[model samples]
Target: MKKLFMPYRGAALQLKNHVVMAPMTRSRAIGNVPNELMAIYYKQRSGAGLIITEGTSPSPEGLGYPRIPGIFTDAQIEGWKGVTSSVHEGGSKIFLQLMHTGRIAHSSNLPEGHQVVGFSAVKAAGEIYTDNGMLEYSAPVALDEAGIARIIDDHVKAAENAIAAGFDGVELHGAHGYLLEQSLNPYVNNREDNYGGSIENRRRMAMEIVQKITASIGADKVGLRISPFLTSNDMPSYEEAAVHETYVQLAREVNRLGIAYLHISNNPGIPEKTHQDIREAFANTIIYCNGFTAETAEEKLQDGSADLVAFGRSFLANPDFMERIEKNSPLNELDYNTLYSPGEKGYTDYPELNYISSITS
Candidate 1:
């Protein structure tokens, strides 16, 4: 069998295949809670070995996007229970991704009393979509020592909640210029305290969160996703050497903690040496995501670059993604419209191979 279709047994994850479903935000969670529609959506695409859920806020303050789900409340946890149960019934492991959109947020998206907070008070130079249409990002309240402590505690509790909700594990959203990645960027984090200044200081918040979460929940049930050079969400480019060192150091520390995996959000800006360095430093499973077809993903697995590969748009468009790959069938094109709109039109209405065959016959 091909490496991509072969079962993977490592890092305490025994997956049915090496293919993983990358997390993509589909704003179908009405009232900021998962529902039966979301459960059906996941169950349809459970052909992948592992599914990392969409960005779920760990607290009320982290709900920076309109309609994104949260795991902080009892209702949210109960909602996610249905989704996890469905995924498990389909014979796939699922992980809840805890993402806190820090400076990359507008006040209109947050709850009544919660305000946007981040490592520093600097606002990201971009507009986020809200119910009131595109709005400028609100100025974040720079977190003091107490605020930072609270953020860490929130993550720990979120991870615990994920396990309670029937998740196989939890993945920390340390990539994509979210709250954790906000601290890594020096241009955004201008604090003079211990959590700022040097490379060690810049990575302190993320490292502390990983360490604490691993302590609270076993290291085997945790994964961290990171993008070293991809400057999404108004993140400015810094010194090249500093960027390389920051992630390499991070890989080493996480390796020491013995986490389940390190998910690298692959991009063109990331140098080959950095990839090699990260692979050498971290001995656990490493998943490479973004812009991969089955052929390329299979090559990545065979070439020893990645133990597993994740597909975002492919799974989003094709529910039986693994089946299509196995049969060498053409994939359905993704509809640009309704990517984040409510309802099941472009979300769960995608046809499977059987449906296509029936129509043609």
Candidate 2:
């Protein structure tokens, strides 16, 4: 009864192994299009089993990181084609994460002549990165029902674009207080309309996007990422329940449609009870990320708490992460200084499995 490299078999798709590289935004793209260098970076890690590409805007309004890629434009799609080709040649599957930043944005990063939009007109707390250092976020314009419908359409178009770009599927960026999460957060969303007021209503918009995208491209090609529960003790109780209920309801709805996966990010500082809820709520493949060491990943996998583990910072520093973990090898500590810095020095220059082999050769 020993399975060192168990395959990840879901309802419709199958990954060669359980090691999935979590999407991390590295500001290295050009004009919001991933470059040839970015392609090589991901291709080098084809050993990850499954690689979730960096958060890509589903529309101009979804812009988060200044240099991050998008799935909207032909140029963007063509840019991703190179990346997909590279990853495929290395023999791996990848998903493009459709990220809509919502209230978590500044005017500088928006499309030319574009304004930020959100579920509510309220402003997000703290500073957002801008060309002129970090600046306070301005109050975003609340989306009318028409605007909400348009965004859903944007996600659908992006899903189609993802498929054309050679992505295996698209993962909706619904967590981390992004646009979808903003709708679910009571603190952020104070609307009295059908998209708000109650937990069911709060979860409505995200569900609609899921239904639209999964329909546009089969549900089996779609995945959702959420960090419904936060480690911040500062979050209100109502917000926590809304997050919890949203995840459960979204999972049930999408699970009914046979979606590929649901990724839940658990901040290490949070209480343990949330794990019990995630275990009971998600019936399909549930991927757990955030502070998951190798031993923890194995433990949770064996216990059926999660189907796969998403390694973020570790994968950044160690491109051969899957092979390393498979062989119980040590990892190179990540260089935080280079983490979103403007260069390939730390991004693509990280050592690969062959490099490590040569060291031992």
Candidate 3:
């Protein structure tokens, strides 16, 4: 519909359309720094209304996956400058996703002095892919009061670094079993202190990070992604009632703080009414993401439930995804093998529809 193509003006983000390119980990940031190749990859897909980058660690301990980008070091910030500038030149707003992997990590992925850490001293179930191969996740050290402070400080610094790197804003990765979500999960956060126990206490770390980051970079420039039902990376699913109660409270509190947007990862079990409830709770923008087709996204927009729709695989495989949807052109198949492998083979090699047609003709 025409609504999906209409410009969306948020508190901090002004996009040319409502199609959002979801944050997806491509694992191409060689040596944990954003590079020119990453710039070219994002630049190629600048047709999206907004681009939320791949998961980028905020600190050394947050490095759970090999080759994932970071914003802590000066070199990382300088490296991201090229990415931000390229995307901007292509006429799209981009947000840097700040992700901390928590217990879902191996020591080899971390810096020499840094060890894996999380809300509790729990070890995640599955193995993580390292440079060597599949390595089992190690039990993380529980964060002390000082460690908690450091994590919050690192998040704020990462947000500042993203701004310095020319990003339009920063999106705190609070979902998909990352550090923030780990703290929110009742199964993972079994601590006896203020950060554990009731839903309010369990949700404290994420709340504090959002508040602190908003303090450092204004609430208008801060966004958060949440998945209350995600079971990946040892995240446990809470009961339906508990999930609604916990996340609705989170939505309300963050809405009071006036955040730019709340990015929701919608799954099967989570009801549509729940999305509507969160939409009502938040004041600014709500981006619903997860296996969405253009038709369904337009329907959601028409129903007034979501302001934007974020596509992950579609945008990844189709560099001109918006254009393809507009013209009803066929989409390219995703190569799962190269999704995490290094180099530009599948990273920046996905061709635009027009380019392919020109060559064929």
Candidate 4:
């Protein structure tokens, strides 16, 4: 077998290669429903061995940004069926990344003006761009035991919906200061209950969600995305000992559950020893994203530091990214203004290999 095209295991995945398409939040869905164009966008790049979708909300109240898609409603499910069907036809496997915005949400984007919910009432220090405009985030309702149970049920339903929509599996988005990450981070979760006292408890919410989701789907169909010390748009890095230790515990506990893979950060120089140490705790496939070059990814793969490398910005600009990597071709520069806009003008309008004339030519 070719070295770069080698197959690998992700706790359960029998995949074609180690190159993964990272989960990107493209604000293109309509009413949290995937459109035909969206399906085409994904199908265009099915050359990657694995494709993890954009962050999809598990519930309406959990929506954090305008036009971000979901996996909850009937329309959304049907819409995603189109996406999965198209991607599969293109000969690629994909995992639906189930995400919850938590306190990162804005009332304007929610249907009933629901207040954002978190591990505590602490409002993350950031702004959320909603349909109305940019809004200052408010303190989230501290999830009581009942609320925690409710959230778990929601995740279960979301996972079921994802599978029903024909996705290979569901990956809990536990990174970038989202809902699951909020419950794990001490800086956001300032509670005294069993859900927040120590590192183990703080990580309890994530574990419970995982347990519920796996129960709804099978263990082989369950995976999780986590950024050890990644700060969000509003949350600064509190990547201290308390935070790092919590994740080490998270990896230890979640690993036994037999998740597909543990998605992590790519900034080795920044996270340094702490990050590498955390990666050592989990004996599963580690997928790393953010600023990864082909050569660097190869080194990590050969060194056994990461089993898979997820490409972010590179994939956006180069739809033929996987082929380009294999053939070492030049990449196209992405147009920034069209990134978040509606329609194919910027999203799917980019040309393929022979379509666009090189700007430098």
Name the candidate that leads on TM-score.
1
- For all predicted structures, in order, the TM-scores are 0.98, 0.93, 0.97, 0.93
Selected candidate, larger TM-score, 1 vs 2: 1
Consecutive 10-residue window with the lowest summed lDDT within model 3:
267-276
Worst 10 residues of 2 by lDDT: 231-240
Give candidate 4's total backbone clashes: 0
The clash numbers for all candidates, in the given order, read 0, 0, 0, 0
Off by over 4 Å in 2: 1-4, 231-243, 269-274, 356-361
| Model 2 per-residue lDDT at 12 | 60
Alpha-carbon RMSD of each model: 0.9, 2.3, 1.2, 2.3
Evaluate model 3: give its TM-score.
Answer: 0.97
Give the TM-score comparing model 4 with the true structure, all chains together: 0.93
All models: lDDT?
0.93, 0.81, 0.90, 0.81
The alpha-carbon lDDT assigned to residue 77 of candidate 2 equals: 93
lDDT of 1 at 63: 91
Best by lDDT: 1
Candidate 3 Cα errors over 4 Å, as ranges: none
Q: Score residue 88 of candidate 2 by CA lDDT.
A: 88
Ordered list by TM-score, greatest first: 1, 3, 4, 2
